[model samples]
Target chain A: MTSSGGLRGYFVRSENARGFSLLAPTLILLVLMMVIPIIMLVARSFWTQSGMIETADFSLVNYQMFFEKKIYLYVLGKSLLISGSVTFATLILAYPAAYFVAFRVKKNKLIWLILITVPFWTSYLLRVFAWKLMLGYNGVVNSGLIGIGIIDEPLGFLLHNVNAVVLTLAHAWAAFAILPIYVSLEKIDKSLLEAAADLGEGPIRSFLRVTLPLSMPGVIAASLLVFIPTVGDYVTPKLVGGSSGIMIGNLVTNMFGRGNNWPMGSAIAVMMMISITLVVCIYLWLISQVKKRSN
Target chain B: MTTVAIDIRGVSKVYNPGSNQAVQALDTVSLTINDNEFFTLLGPSGCGKTTLLRLIAGFEQVTGGEIMLFDEEIENLEPSQRPVNTVFQHYALFPHMTVAQNVAFGLERLKKPQAEIDATVERVLSLVKMKELGDRRPNQLSGGQQQRVALARALAPSPKVLLLDEPLSALDLKLRQNMREELKQLQRETGITFVFVTHDQEEALAMSDRIAVMSNGEVQQIGAPTDIYEHPVNRFVADFIGDTNFLDGEITSVNDDLVTCRVGSESLFEAANSGNHSVGDQVTLFLRPEKITLSAAGDASRQGRVANIVYLGNQAAYTVDMGDGIELTAQARPREDGNLPFATNDTISVDYSARALRVLAK
Candidate 1:
């Protein structure tokens, strides 16, 4: 009885046991909602689909086909290039807006931050469609320019290409890039700028040496936040990406829906996730290396 | 002849510190600090001592007057353009940079060669005695160590003038005392004109070759530590610098620099005077507590019963209640055998030299 009670007490009274109990509900929900699906997806990746029937035997046939096809690799590389551009474009656009909120807007900072997030309030699909209206062949930009007599004809380059995908994704994920950078900039000591000036640095040089480097953490976070999600975004690419902007996500969707290849889709999906994870790890390592030398 | 390091001529600043609509923070304040001298702007918070310092440092523009650094106009120059650096109140060391990096920042900004920059950084770091911790970031070091790095960083460029804004206020009492001597020694060793701003009168007295006591956006008095402590020109300076007994009185008679005052019928009489004040002019007599000696009531100028006795280590303070609503505080060292001179409720004589008291125009 003592031994049994001792074992029960360990489960009930230990720090680890108490902590686990606190997170028990969240853990259970996460396993049910996320972990089980991911495990099933991995399992399906090793299966073979044969004409309206999926054979559940373990096989690498889908993987072998993915490697055999060069289109998948090309699309994946294009997706990476597009996502990288999106991250860069969003960062450059967001940095100044975030700086204005963090430094210039002494009053009503909350209003400024909320205004940044206002564009993202609508449904994601609608926002992508809105970008469609703005950048379409007979879009607002092209039509407005034509009406102003600035151009002779509608610019076909305005829509349905890699540029359209990049512009739309960058605009969609702008708030994520801005808020973190704003927080980092706001956390910097204002007196450091004054000290920098006192130490004989011009306004521009002071900002480059002190303000830019100090706000790197937020910059890195913003980059990853924009890059990771936009890499696999299919809706924006499908609506605007005609040929050149097609990404890995579109390929996976095709295999699952029209192509009738669930195993191939799973395999492609798993590979995309692995690729994003690998890129993020490398980016973080490079950022750390740069930071180490800054000191 | 000594050269003037900073010639602040009628430099008035009108600034709104966000709390109020607009405060004339510095009012036509003029001062001349000599080269290589440690000058202090001593005042309580919001008294415009810091405003003057900031104006001199080129952080703010003067509304009315010009400031000359080494006899060259600098009010229009940017804070960066001025050849001066500040040791900020909070140090403001870059949180990301290591100690060595922070020290090298100023040198590197001047476009000095890499070897010269490295050597200067090394020398200043060791001068502040933070040689081994140069690799540690500001956040990793203790407050005192960060203070040394801030000092080293400000000193690295060897600016003509170094403005220190209460850089020792954040440290504990013991550490603060140690830093005070070290900072003074640094000023001597570097021979740089040090402009120190602080509210602590003792720190100013101990460190500054000359102190400018400020009040209500004006320079109340500017003199050496001894002159400021001993012969304050106005009531504000006398009251703000130390503990003193202020007795409102009318000037009864004037004799050169000595004026006799009538306080509550019994004119307890002549005190040192400043400026021109005719007889019957309203004035105040201030006597330092330490200047007064306590003894048992005898044939004396005035007598009061001791109302309270506060036992301080090595000394005691006696609150004496004289007639006509007048009370006086006198501090006395304990008797040679380690006992107080008198207990509470005992009548005592308040004895002070006429030279030890001063009269200020009300």
Candidate 2:
């Protein structure tokens, strides 16, 4: 009987092993689709460009070129600045709206959340195109301003500029910012607010100390959601950014699409990924420091 | 010497506007809590005891009347503005904060100097005997420990009135008993006006100097715990406060505070005080379980069959199956002779003095 029991235990362990093995296909697929490509991109960054197949020789020449060329450096700096601005603006706008949705608008919460997410249901490219029309020289915005006599003529700053790209990205990612913030605010126990009030905190103080700090996780998540995608987006800049409005993403796209420099493009892509990872790590570390000091 | 800490005059709360199903949570409730007194609101569920506590805390608005705190009209004041702190039923400690941080939250809000806040937090934590666990987060602590932290947090503010809403209900039985003693000690040490809300009669009796027994959104009776337990004003209060053997009878004779009642064909009972009773009026006499004495020998006033005997540690409780649809319980103290006084299936007589029985108004 003991031997049979041991055999049954062995069978159970084997069943678990079989279950894990069944999951191997999906795991392998994910690695192939995501991890392997990223690894390849990083590896390719070290290779020098050749006629057809890149040179087998590896060097830091591509990275040096990224720094040596003022255009690439400018593009990288502009990309960081633009994405940072978008992130801060999105958070500023989203936090209050999310607080309102979570605390004030109690009923039909799901419906409101769905309404926020409705923009994502339509094609992202279509949304960009719609923004393009709205910001065009003769579009609704320019016409409205001119109609109201705010300006003598249509301003060239609205379309095919950095402002247009930033505006489009902000509109596109507002939903991302709102949802996580709403969820975090919703998870806060109402009694905490009451406790704050009972502890002699006015409405403003309670909001600053309790509500804002507790919702940090959501803010971090929203920041990452906007920053990560905005850093790598070539489409928005390509359509809306004119001559001087080019970013690192557009540079990388040019290397692949027009310049036919795959190795160079992969190098730029790897750098962008590294920069984003470093920024996110620094943000997370800073937040942890703040949390530690507060405690 | 006798400043009223809280004066609630004719307060009521009706929730939900422009709806047919609006509930009158509190109705015309008036109460005066003396300074430094441990007052308890004791009631069953949905009795608006917590609502009353909240109204005093300034967490809820009084629909009609006014609440005064230390001669100040505080019904319109915010919760923060009132010199009151509440220990919530769930002990709602900030989960992200450590015990020390939770305790310091109120002081921080007061914007006291750093040194003062630190000293106060440490003092309160030590008061709750939770100084060692101050560094631990709320989730890391046990339920009893969390309760202490909550108490420390509320007390750290040095509020005049401390409101506890079923604070001990979450603890285990043994822990609850121990915490009750600790809480009483703390209250005595602090000498703050404590307004505790609880549905547990034993807790109310053990803790409070005075208890207000509430039901159906109204205060049925409010008095010292002994009076509330022994001389409950009505049937609901009597039934709610303790275990009582109710004898239904008609008052055959009445004179001032004395009333003679006939229980059945032969048995006659005399209650010392029948409040607002007339001759030939039907009333219920509430005799506590411990008040009745069981004897095997026949008594003139009462007789019954011993239906069951429960052997509790120090005392034996006998359930007498009095025929004519009446049942009574009597307790017998353990004796050195080691002889069982009563047994099941044995006929016995249950007797109590006239003073032991309270005639409750319906």
User: Given the true complex, what DockQ would model 1 score?
Assistant: 0.81
* Per-residue C-alpha lDDT of model 2 across residues A148-223, encoded as one tens digit per residue: 9998889888888888888888888999999999999999999899988988888998888788888989999999
Against the true structure, candidate 1 has what lDDT? 0.91
Candidate 2 — which pairs collide? Answer: none
Q: lDDT tens string, model 1, A1-295?
A: 9999998899887999889988999999999999999999999999999889999999999989888999988899889999999999999999999999998998899998999999878999999999899988899999999999999899999888999999999999999999999999999999999999988898899989999988988999999999999999999999998887799999999999999989999999999999999999998898888877765
Which sections of candidate 1 miss by over 4 Å?
Answer: A1-18, B16-20, B253-259, B265-267, B273-278, B297-301
lDDT of 2 by residue, B198-258 (tens): 9999999999999999999999999998899888888899899888888889888888767
DockQ of predictions, in order shown: 0.81, 0.69
Residue A235 of model 2 has an lDDT of: 87
Model 2 misplaced stretches (Cα beyond 4 Å): A1-11, A15-19, A48-61, B255-257, B264-267, B298-301, B334-340
> Where is the poorest 10-residue window by lDDT in model 2 chain B?
B293-302
Q: Using DockQ as the measure, which candidate wins?
A: 1
Per-candidate TM equals 0.94, 0.94
